[model samples]
Target: MSVNENLAFDALSDRVRRQILSILGEGGELTVTEIAESVDMVGRSTVSSHLRILRTSGVVNERRDGRRRYYSLDTEGSVRDAFLFLQTILRGGVHFDVEATKSADVAGEIQQDVS
Candidate 1:
């Protein structure tokens, strides 16, 4: 598969990663332990490993607060850029750009439309 397809599938493969994104949406930031606890699916180490993938992929941002690490989703702008990488393999050759990312200034635009 292409890089874009890889990213979306990678993001979707583990249930933990999807939940992590949800938690980040709520807390805006969470430590490794906190995330593990919130999901109750696996250990902190497991969550950390997933976080590593997300961090490396530029889907999530991390910051260290002393011994604790906090993570959150990249803003719409950032995620849009990442999602655009998958556009090439969207079952069509159509291209997507930053301007296409914007719909309304209203919050929950993505979540609302998707559901």
Candidate 2:
């Protein structure tokens, strides 16, 4: 998978993927089994596929424990920076306080709040 531009947001566009990120971000690392249990899907394969896309986007990192694989967020700095850059380009003069919040922690959850 390519970690190209907008990959994180693009990957987040899907509900399941976003839920996966939210679960990982709010809690911490988890395996495909745990993630599958949270979402509508009941199969590990489905969760694994979503995790793969997130990992490719640099939005999640993975760690292995024995036969289990755990994944967590990886967009703490880069994500917030991207949103600030967008605000700068869109808002012009950039009056907003970019330092007010951390991007990694919010990620797709912010959009959920606004919508």
Candidate 3:
């Protein structure tokens, strides 16, 4: 994988970051406060840190609305590239057994759904 792809995957390696991405993927944009609420046990500063990493990785877009910043998935950037890269790998004769991975948590379950 390329460096950009590697960075994207690295950003996604953290469970908290993945949860943030899941919130963004669900629908409309959310402010930092709103995002903090959705994630368990994470404080504002921590969420901000995750958002910073995600923004730096190009997986998310940030919009300034007055005093607040709203974050959402970046449709045309690293997130797209990451998904495309995974698709390419899966299409190259790789096969997965979904039932075998079902007992894992939501993070692992996502791959089963994709498969």
Off by over 4 Å in 2: 1-4, 76-81, 87-115
Q: Model 3, 11-39: lDDT tens per residue?
A: 99999999999988885699999999889
Predicted candidate 1 versus true structure: per-residue lDDT over 2-102, tens digit per residue: 46446656775778888888888898887887788897788888888998987776678899888778888876434456566665457353324333444
Global lDDT of each candidate? 0.72, 0.73, 0.87
Ranking by TM-score: 3, 2, 1
> TM-scores of all models?
0.60, 0.64, 0.77
Off by over 4 Å in 3: 93-115
Kindly list the per-residue Cα lDDT of model 2 for residues 1-115, writing each as its tens digit: 2234477668778888888878887778888887888877446788898889888777788899999888888766334555555666767434343533456448668888899
Cα-lDDT of candidate 3: 0.87
Each model's backbone clash number: 0, 0, 0
* TM-score between candidate 1 and the true structure: 0.60
lDDT of predicted model 2: 0.73
Better of 1 and 3 by lDDT: 3
What shift in Å separates residue 3 of candidate 3 from its native position after superposition?
2.6
Off by over 4 Å in 1: 1-5, 76-78, 82-115
